[model samples]
Target: MSTLIAGTPLAGRVAVVTGASSGIGEATAERFAELGAKVALLARRKDRLEDVAERITSKGGIALALPTDVTDRAAVRAAAERISVELGNVDLVFANAGVQLISEIGDLKTEDWDAQIDLNIKGVMNTIQAFVGSLEAAGTDGRPADLITTSSIAATRVLEKFQVYSGTKAYISHITRLLRTELGRKNVRVSTVEPGMVNTELPDHVTDPDASKLMADLIHQIDVLQSADVAETVSFVAALPKHVNLTELTILPTAQII
Candidate 1:
């Protein structure tokens, strides 16, 4: 079989993925590299970031591993400067750094709620703040620019214990809609990918025993979507024609009712 399909579809493009250490972020970074985009990975895990970058480089793909805590604006901005100097203008950004801490509203796991708010909501805002300038510049240069955010079906679905997590994701979904109104005028595509029950480490973080069992049972009951599945959708969005924008997509496993 021919490797990498036809010509490099994303040749000369620059992609930045937050939470690029694992799951959807890592998969999408590798996919972007496969299509010839110079990729920059930003996340808190230094070791894992290096591992992803090493694998991509081994396959003759260019990748930059920038260990960053997305909640830290200064750190994110510093990393953005490095990306601009090393990878050129970043036209593609995936604000995918997030955590799912599910618990009942009355239980009041305030710490868990804070963690979700910091990483899922504030982190996304920081990423957009760092990259929007470059994305706008790319648009001015008549190039395709895209900003994609990873949300979850929990955003809309009425789950019992996913109060804070759902709220955070809903923030992401709506923010993407609002961002598109402004960035879209500049020809920078802004979209959100809302996946339903993806088989990712996110489920492992739920400390609520009831919620954990519910998630475990759901995973066992169906073939949950994998990280690669979501990555493919994200890459497809970025690879479309410059004028085409797939605004909001909800990806669900065939067996998943929601």
Candidate 2:
């Protein structure tokens, strides 16, 4: 009797994950590598990317660290080119590089707003733009590609002091929907992964006292989500058959309520 499981489902596939330095991005890259995919790790932090790549290579998985700032279009394109040369055509891409700047409506912090918009919105665009051509080409060659974006549950649900961050995520959420419509015919799958209350350094970047307090309260109230949980979801989605496309996935802690 043969088992109905295939090991290394992503064997021969190349995956690119932005924001690979830590948290969800790091976990996704490691998960992809574990599943036998050659992973390209992209982030602004060279040391962190190198560390993640070292762990992957040490575990007998292929990984390449390409330090990049997703907000820069040229840097993202160059990183994509390097991935093409080193890992072959990318079969999967996780546009997960993002930052959260939480402030109340009256705070009037234009810099925080700009930071969130640039990294969360433009960064996502740069990643998608840099890889869409390759993904489409891969499809034409009979290999369907997957594009997954890391959104936030805040996009759909209201969260205090998350106004700008939520708006940016919502933008990407709709953009992902549009991409799915545009790329479906070409056999490229586009999806968004929205998570809630993940215990990551994301909240640490918040400067608003009220927002920080809210984050702390949320963490104390519910079972916090983990980077591994999101990573598992990403791997599961990526491992599915090419014909299956999970358009949007919202992952939340069981104890959390909208």
Candidate 3:
């Protein structure tokens, strides 16, 4: 069992977690709440969001479930505004919502490619643009605030049928690096978590039959990392001291490989 020492590191802080309906996002929200942060859960599914919120509340943690679609700029902005108004200045923002599609270039559908770009790229942009001001505002207190995003190992390695998906993740990595440079002077920290072979709904989005089979086989071949693994990493980054920023972390199951 992992022990949680609670009091100062994240006490009285407010965090917004996008894609909080399930998977890594949901896990991260729960972990943050456990660490004494008031958490805002944002995702498109109202029922699912409420469920997560209820879980946190039941556990004696503060939580708000805001049904949101990260792909919609206006919705994202409104969510951010509401968090600022209700939760006070935001202390952390986790742009953890994403999708994946795998197909060969010849068989790849244009619409699918666009979907990946919009959510994986543009969605991230909207989250950052919406909450950046809040992060800046929080910095005035002389404490470091954080912005974290989830990228996959695919970003670094180009696997056989995941061209567009890999492209989107690669873009995430690039944006994270640039944002780190841009936000450094502002006392806001930016970090990226790259996870490999996690057991989640990621494979459900794979439309290509061949690719789906391949992914399933790979999962069976390894004791895939769980969503909790990535969640722990997010909490670790958030718990770091003001001047110490864990820039990037890559996690993979012991049996998995590039």
Alpha-carbon lDDT, every model: 0.91, 0.90, 0.88
Every model: Cα RMSD to truth: 1.8, 3.0, 1.4
- TM-score of model 3 vs. true structure: 0.96
Off by over 4 Å in 3: 1-8
- Measured with C-alpha atoms, the lDDT of residue 186 in candidate 3 is 88
* Candidate 1 runs further than 4 Å off: 1-6
Clash totals, every prediction:
0, 0, 0
Model 2: CA > 4 A from native = 1-6
Q: What is the TM-score of each candidate against the true structure?
A: 0.96, 0.95, 0.96
Task: Give the best candidate by lDDT.
Answer: 1
The full ranking of all candidates by lDDT, starting with the best, is 1, 2, 3
Extract clashing residue pairs from model 1: none
